[model samples]
Target: MVTTKRNKEFCQKVRLKSTQVFIVAGTCLITVLVTLLCIGFMTRYEVDNEVANVADVDYWKDKVASSQKIWYDKGIDELNEALRTPRGPIYPKNLRIFLIQGVDGRDLAAYRFSGKDLSNGNTNFVWDKFPHFARLKNTCSQQFPCPISSVAKSLWTGIPLDKIPEAQPDCGNLVNETETPFSVLRQAQLAGLLTGFVTTQRFTGSTGAALGNTNSNYECDERMPLGSLKSGCQDIARQLITGETGKSLNVIIGGGRQMLSSLVPKSISDPVDELLCESNDGRNLLKEWRNQKLKESKVKPIKFELVQRADELESLNASNFDFLFGVMANGDLSGNSNAPSLKLMVEKSLQVLKKKNQGYLLIVEQFIQSGMNKRKELQLLNETLTNLKREEDTLTLVLLTNAIYPKPILDMSEETETINQLSETFNEAEFQIQETLYQMPSESLLFAIGPKSSIFHGVQKETFIAHAVSHVLSKSSPKT
Candidate 1:
């Protein structure tokens, strides 16, 4: 009996020791797991904070400003309307309008002059007119003249403004055929809506060439020179505007009249008034297009018209032509502020293009939004124009509001003081002081309005605009 009791006690002790060991081991395992989990959570938090910080930097601030303006001004309303409105898949036969070439979209958001305001004896501000920088009291100081070029470069690349190339120094031979914009245009042409190119720059300039045939060289080809290099503008006007392209172009309009005159010009002293006498090339261009139309009786004949003034454009019969060209100015058409309004241009183009039951593609550009002030104007203009298009079955797309302007940050103290000052000073200020206090950072903005604008918002590359246009056009085409 004594031996049995001793053995049982020994066994009990052994069991106690093992239990303690197990408990200690389990606690250690739990501790390790908790530590690992804490570390992972901390890492994720840090990463998220870093991302937010980067977004707050100058570049993203500009983007946010421009994008928010569109959203606040018209995008949201347009989106709601689109969602509520029933849409038939875009018909291939509908006319296509394009706005390209030049700095556009900066001040487009600010051009919000209401008709009621205009009519109500409030001439405090002109709604559609471009505002000069000198008129802005809040304009940046001399120390920081608005960085227009820097902003333009940044917007084009979607990078920080400082990172953009200062100049495009001759990057060797330009393999123009391979550029993405040209490829997009080629695809557009192949899809079958009548193709047209209009611009204020040389036909060979980056934007202009994107629409026309690609060449290994940038200079107008040997076939089309009038005077010297300085005089090449005339050559561009005559040759490309009226010159033969193997393909039947539905429309061609823009400046560069001096380029069209030949060595044989005699009577007209004013180079602008000189008529493009029928050169072999001009006759051939006309003959070839005529023959093509005759051969394919189903196709519409290409009608050509040169418009120097807005009044001239207004007089044309909308029903008469399938193709129309108007060169409004000698050089780049007047900046949006100084030039005839884009509203006017859009109206005229639509009139001509819509005449065809078969549909048409028209590209209209307002090329003055390169600077900060102009960008703001472009933005406002876009909003106004978009509102105007409410009744039409149109899709308007805006590209590259991406230019980066220097950050305009008002610290919390300044913002508070400004608000207080405004409240005390103005008895009946219609505009909110806070709205003016929170100035936009200069950044590029891109958006699309009309039927399918929602497809574009958020961050995207420039080429995507080209892709979207093609995709939209393709969906709308008759073959599809």
Candidate 2:
């Protein structure tokens, strides 16, 4: 499920997430600024359109090649050092963020999905067992009804979206790392937690969410780089794996094997790119990961493994390796027939992350499918949640939909027709909305289950998610 009907509408309604912040060698980066450090980001360099083309696959194949141009003037080591701070002493055992993206209030009404005290209209399955539900008022702001990108930024750095310079119309490129001084993930990592961010949704860039969508402030210790199919310029996979930041991610999964599998096509529109999607750049990163393990370090070393299929991922002994890198497709996994199920990915990631005693932060992005399948997914999730051990150390929060309905699809459907009919005809385009309100929608669903979850109540902006994580990290601090 790439996007809900709302997501498809967002494609037309929202353009900010896709707005370019920085385009170096066709590689996109967002410039987030905290102090005056971001003053001259725009003037720093001009990407020669011709030079940006991926012609010299030989030169581009070098791991350092993509980031070399930008890292030179910026001082990569200094930037990474500045970004890396000491973590706290108290590490939460389990903290997971299950973000079901692009799901609107109307989508909830598509069928009868309920939890504990939550339920919409008449329905077949009663999700009465799901627990700790709540909602956020207006998604982000007045201008943009869909504030996935804006909310993501605020949620990451604790800075309101409008306050971001990178968010400006022309300075959109700045929406990336240029202005970001810190992020929830960075803070968590500093606190010594193993972190991984996996998203079924392709690339959102700055336009998606602040640190959540992109590698802004090193959102995840590792990622499942589900790269885009765009040619010429390198996709996100190349930029991140080879980013000049120097902070290493432990595991990356998902699709877009095209980007990392081989050389990016010289022409952005090269037709043969398909055959060569998984092109060999000569630098096999999986082998590189194994090579990385050969060199012993002063600190504890990370073990590595690379697998291509779901069974292979499941078969691995989680304790045997620290860094796991694998790809399942040539592009996004949302609707891919061959890609492993999201359920499998989440379960596998959790299986591996649970091995670490320090605890972890897993960010899972799921595009909700409407109607029965959607409700079933919710049911499956609830069943999964029911099985988890929720102690003081665990915090499983699901940021479900909170928007008001657009004309109410259920209302438009004939009274005699079952919920199934309305769902079958559903298309995200027709449900697009523009106006905004913050009050939690009457039929909304948000769950804050497990240990510390009860602390959240009433209305909230999604940024509160970060605040909660921050509070835990502070306790982890040795000074505390």
Candidate 3:
């Protein structure tokens, strides 16, 4: 009986020790959690403070203005120098063109990879493919690195967004229609060269619209003010269909079918279609464009094809169609399985444009976001460049916008709201959207290859590109 009692006491002691251990562990866990919470709270506080201090809208605006002034002076000097340079005898009729946008310094730096082979087992860098390509320092707009502004300046010499004082300062509004200068594509069209436009963005997006539009208040009909429409302003899509430069285009391929169509009833096959059919106007711009071509066909032997599917695009015999229009998506291209790839579009465009013996100019605009996808895009671009280089007469120009949004104001707290209100008085919201927290202006790069590529070898203003093209094409002898 005494031994049994001793065993029970020992068991009680063991239970007591286990209870004490549990309590001690619980205390340690609680203490650790509290410490973590404190650290997180402190970090968040520091971040908030940094954001508040750095996101001073007034300071940002002042810095932009000062920097713009410096660029403007430099641009003026470069423009004058280009004007003074001897005009080269470039054969316009023999020259085929590929003007590419959406490359940046990061892309070029990737080429330097310490002479190492890429993970994809490619030993040659993209630049190595075109050893003759000249690397030039390209500048963005003197005022802002807006996509529309940069494009306008690149297409029409000496004209940037800030220079157009008459047009309302907005991304959707390009040059004043009355004051609009002839674009490089327009010049090529007038010179009897077949022209084409290809993009991964909306067909009516800023880059595409700047090619042909003027005094445009919005990209789509739904986005335009009724007053503006009544005042004889047309949306970008309408401009592309009806405008002189736009109509003369031999090839038009990209996305943004929703902007062209009115309430296209979504079918079961396209249940996940992201295109919202946002047009309230009772007109289908695509049909209108087709009808216009059809009417012309009745008068002449004009062959045209309009397609909405990637498969349809693939099946098309580009040589059979004098004009090709393909809207591969409802909105901006998502590079999905069904959408036509950038390289595919370029190949098709090349086929269509090459048919015209008078020569051709193709504007390929791609908007690449930052990160790993950018690398993939660079690879695709290299493939396209290879195809372009196959034509000995083709001159390909790659334009890059580095950090398109420079020093973006990230914080939009109460303090920022107050700054925005103050800035609204000075039209800051016009160029820089009040709600946008990212994107800042930065330097860009220019790469060129083929005949007369020497003209763009040095650091020059963005306008110099158009100036050089104008000089070469206008002064050159026509092909026999």
Instruction: Tell me, by TM-score, which candidate is best.
Output: 3
lDDT of 3 by residue, 53-167 (tens): 2222122335567757665655554445333322333443444444445555545566535345544332344544332333333233232333444445444544644464344
Q: Write the per-residue lDDT of candidate 1 for residues 1-480, one digit (tens) a residue.
A: 999999999999999999999999999999999999998888688677542232222323355677466445444443343334335444334434334333323333343344445432322222222111111011111114454533322222233434433322233333342442233444555676555555434334444443443322222324443333333332222334333331445655554333332232222222332232223333223334444555555554455554555678777664466556554543344421233445555665665555443445565444443444554545544553654544345555444332233444333233344456775645545465434533433223454444555565555444445556667677655453
TM-score for all models, in order of appearance:
0.48, 0.55, 0.65
Clash list (residue pairs), candidate 3: 405-439, 405-440, 406-440, 406-441
User: Relative to the true structure, how large is the alpha-carbon lDDT of every model?
Assistant: 0.44, 0.50, 0.64
| lDDT sort, best first | 3, 2, 1
**Of the candidates numbered 2 and 3, which has the greater TM-score value?**
3
TM-score of 3: 0.65
Question: lDDT score, residue 246, model 1?
Answer: 18
Give model 1's TM-score versus the native structure: 0.48
State the local distance difference test value for candidate 3: 0.64
lDDT of 2 by residue, 145-232 (tens): 3434455566667666566433222223344555554567667666766666666544223312344333332122123232322212
- List residue ranges in candidate 3 displaced over 4 A: 1-102, 111-123, 128-157, 165-179, 265-277, 335-337, 407-441, 475-480
- The worst-scoring run of ten residues by lDDT in candidate 3 lies at 51-60
